[model samples]
Target: MKTIPVQLKSKDYDILIGRGLRAQIGTEVAKVWSKRKIALVSDKNVAELYLKEVHQSLEDAGFDVLDLVVPAGESSKSLAQMGDLVQQMADAGFTRADGVLALGGGVVGDLAGFTAASYMRGIAFIQVATSLTAQVDSSVGGKTAVNLKEVKNIIGAFYQPDLVLVDPDFLDTLSDRDLVEGYGEVVKTSVLHGQDFFALTGKIKSVQDIREQAEELSIHSIRYKAKIVMADEKESGQRQFLNFGHTFGHAIELLSHGSLRHGEAVSIGMVMISQRFEAVGITEKGLTDEIAQRLAAVGLPIDSDLVGTPLFFKHIVNDKKNRGGILNLVAVKNVGEPVIVAKALDDMHDFV
Candidate 1:
């Protein structure tokens, strides 16, 4: 087992990563959180496979488990679904003393975490990350939110989890596409960390490689994020590095209208922004090709035809990074070096 501690001033927590950690969920959770009644939130797809095992584990640990399953997809992260979940928890007699346990992927984690953060003001939240995306990225970060029609993760909170269990065991059942989709964030982290991780990520060629190296790669991404989160918990300054590919990535995602996965979108965004920035001399020459080559090596695309979508500009301006009139864009100078470049929202159309 590998333990990485995220030492926030008030909400410090540990992220436990290992192969068989899923089976030890209940026991592991009991060590940090003492809540008696907990809501086990999952999606329909995941519930059919590992829900019973996880639920049984929680029950064995003396938890009054409330199994809350929702539809599985990006759509689940919505105001309607969040309201329904809050009402259900209220109907179940939940209190601030209780907690929430997210059992599926990012959707479940985001929804459950947000619900826990808002339930009677706040409650403990734990993450049992199932997907590679969740385990490697979303599971470790305290950022939680649902979508707002066109915008993604627009309404959310920075609520840290009490504990996060990232067991590679749960990754066994993911589809090939689902697994590869996660490499987008991996590639993003690699670029942010510089040469060491950049070279390491380039070695991942298949799901077999990812499975074999999950623990190591997960730790790399978590440590990078945890360090940045601890320094700039509310994204005042230093934390913007984490949004390296996300400005255009999120815009591309909104424009695709769910056609592309989040990671895929980010992959294209990373390369696109790098390509455009490198052309303008903001990013180092050859950096775009390097990023594109690594992403393509792992089967992630570096470009998308949706870049021409008329709604593209609109989505870009709506991003959270666009504070006041300046868009805080993350651009690359070299491998492992990312810089934030502020651009006027009105002047964005010609930058592409």
Candidate 2:
């Protein structure tokens, strides 16, 4: 097992990554919560696969575990579900002293993390991310929230987890499409960091290659994000780079109405943004095409069927990064270079 420390202003935490670390969750979690009960939040899919193992581990460690299972999917991240989970935690005798165990992919992490953040005004929590997307992206960052009717991740908080336990073995059950979708996020991280890191993706083609390189790839991606988050935890500056493809990605997801996966949408969004950069002469045409082609190779669409440029631009206007009606955008000057552009909302239509 390899443990990485994430240093934060409020408190420092550890991210333990390895194969078969699920069996050690109880002892690992015990270091934070001694006799305090833990409320575990998971979805139906993950619950069927590993919930029993987690329950047995915690039970062996003498923890009073209360299991709360929600239906799996993006739609489950609603205000109603959040309220229900909060009520469940309370009925189970939870307190600020107790911990929350987020035991699924991004949706479960976001919902449960927000619950832990809001319940009792804030409680300790641990993340046991089950998907590749969650392990490399959402689980490490403290950004937790559910979606609102009008916006994606609009209602969320930046509450850091007490610990992040990532077991790559959990990925064995993922379908081919889901596995391929995760590479979109991996590619995003690679682009933000640089080309050498991006080149590592070349060796990864099949699902087995993704698995064999999972440990190193996850650690490398997390390290880049951790450094950026540490430098600007509140996102006043450098951390914005992490949202390289997210602004456009979130808009596509909104337009698709949850029909499109987040990473898949982001893959297309990244391609679109790269094209915008090329149009403005900020990036070379070949490089932009290469990015789109690579994403296509992994089964992510580089363009969407959504029919209106103005509507797509409207979503960009609503993005959280828009400041004073000006969009703080990240564009590529080349494969290894990312430049931030501040543009007025009116000028966005030309690019879209």
Alpha-carbon lDDT, every model = 0.88, 0.85
For model 2, how does the per-residue alpha-carbon lDDT over 1-352 read when each residue is reduced to its tens digit?
Answer: 8888889889899888899899899998888777778888999999999999998899888889999999998888888899999898888878888988999999999999999999989998899989989888889879999888757888989999999998888899998777777778888888778888788876666667787888888887888888888888888887888788788888888888768888888898888888788888887777777777667766777887662456777778779999998988888777667778888888877767
Clashing pairs in 2: none
In angstroms, give how far residue 21 of model 2 lies from its true place: 0.7
- Residues 1-352, model 1: lDDT tens digits: 9889999887789999999998899999889878489899999999999999999999998899999999999999999999999999999999999999999888899999999999999999999999989988998879899999988888999999999999888888998789888878888999999799989987887767887887888889988988888888889897898888788788888888888899999999998888889989988898888888877876887898777566888888778888998999898788877788989987887887
Candidate 1 minimal-lDDT segment of 10 residues: 305-314
Clash list (residue pairs), candidate 1: 194-336
Give the number of the best model, judged by lDDT: 1
- Candidate 1 deviant stretches above 4 angstroms: none
